[model samples]
Target: MKILVCISKTPDTTAKIAFADNNTKFAADGVQWIINPYDEWYALVRAIELKEADPSTVIHLVTVGGADCDPIIRKALALGGDEAIRVNADSHDSFYIALQIADIAKKGSYDLVFTGKETIDYNGSSVGGMVAELLEMPYVSLATKFTLIGSEAEIVREIEGGEETDKVALPLVVSCQKGMAEQRIPNMKGIMGARSKPLNVVEPVAADTLTSIASFDLPPAKASVKLVSPDTPEELVRLLHEEAKVI
Candidate 1:
């Protein structure tokens, strides 16, 4: 089986985020980048687990970004991705990014496509579904568990109140979440092997981007915590009803 995993580079969670170019561009200086955790810990790791279960399976990783994103792709390779593909493009627009990935998936004839439920940076959670739609294939989002038997797949995902189980044939796209798999750390052997893995850079297909970022501003600073005495239950109720508006 050929499984394609979509990976993305995102600013490390602890990195200080900033904006530039009149708040229209992200500030990259001094920011550490890493594979989006959803991609690494769930989507990619689950694909690796599948490969480990079946030696004939091949896992290919793909990303949409410029040359600077190579390290992130390499990291995916180090985590057991057989090969990598880089779609040379700016992935700010979800539709455009989905187009690139969908085109690759079509040409590659991948049996299964996997991606994180959402990227940490933008948290759009749109690309995987768009890719599935563009390819006219089935897609499941926020899948917590996945199992493959022959050409059929068994998937479990979270829904409104609880988990929903599903079954789909091959040529499926899934956006994975936390319960899908455990995180894998790259060992010395895997790291060394990744250095020599094939990393193909491809041009993106033509696609019209429908949206653009206008500006970015930090959230308002958090207010100090207010304490209410246990005896003054009415005060707490009043605050929740009036100030917080959460009652």
Candidate 2:
């Protein structure tokens, strides 16, 4: 079995976020980047688990970004991917990135594709569906559990009020979520082996970006909490009716 896992670099959670170029671009100075958590913890880890269950299974990691994304890719390799591919392009548009990944998936003839439910920075949950559409494959999103049985895959995904189960054939795409797999930390051996792993860089195919950032605005500051005395129930009621306005 061959699997393609899509990963991306994102700002560390603790990194300060700011905008530049008249609020049209992200400020990257002094910011630290890491593998997007959902990709690393759920999507990639689940692929690694599948590879572990079957040694013949080949796992390949792919990312669409410039050379600066290498470190994040290397870290993902350290977690257990057989090889990595980097698409040399820089764009925030989800369709553009999905196009590059779909191109690679076509050339590789992978049996399965995996991606995180969404990126932490943008929180855009569109890439996986776009890739599936571009490849004309079955897509299952927000998958919390995935099991492979022969050429078929059994998946459990979260829905509005409950979970839904699906069984799809090979050459399908899944967007993984929290319960998919446990996070794995790179050990010394894995880290050492990752240094020798092949990281192939490829140029992106021709695709027009359909989206652009207009501007970014920070959320308004939170209001201070108001304390209500337990003895003054009438005052609390008045406050809730007049200021809080919930009642």
Best by lDDT: 2
Which 10 residues in a row give candidate 1 its minimum summed lDDT? 87-96
Candidate 1 structure quality by residue, lDDT tens digits, 200-221: 9999989999898889999989
List of clashing residue pairs for candidate 1? none
Q: TM-score for all predictions?
A: 0.94, 0.95
lDDT of 2 by residue, 83-156 (tens): 99999999999999999999999999999999999999999999999999999999999999999999999999
TM-score, candidate number 1: 0.94
What's model 2's TM-score?
A: 0.95
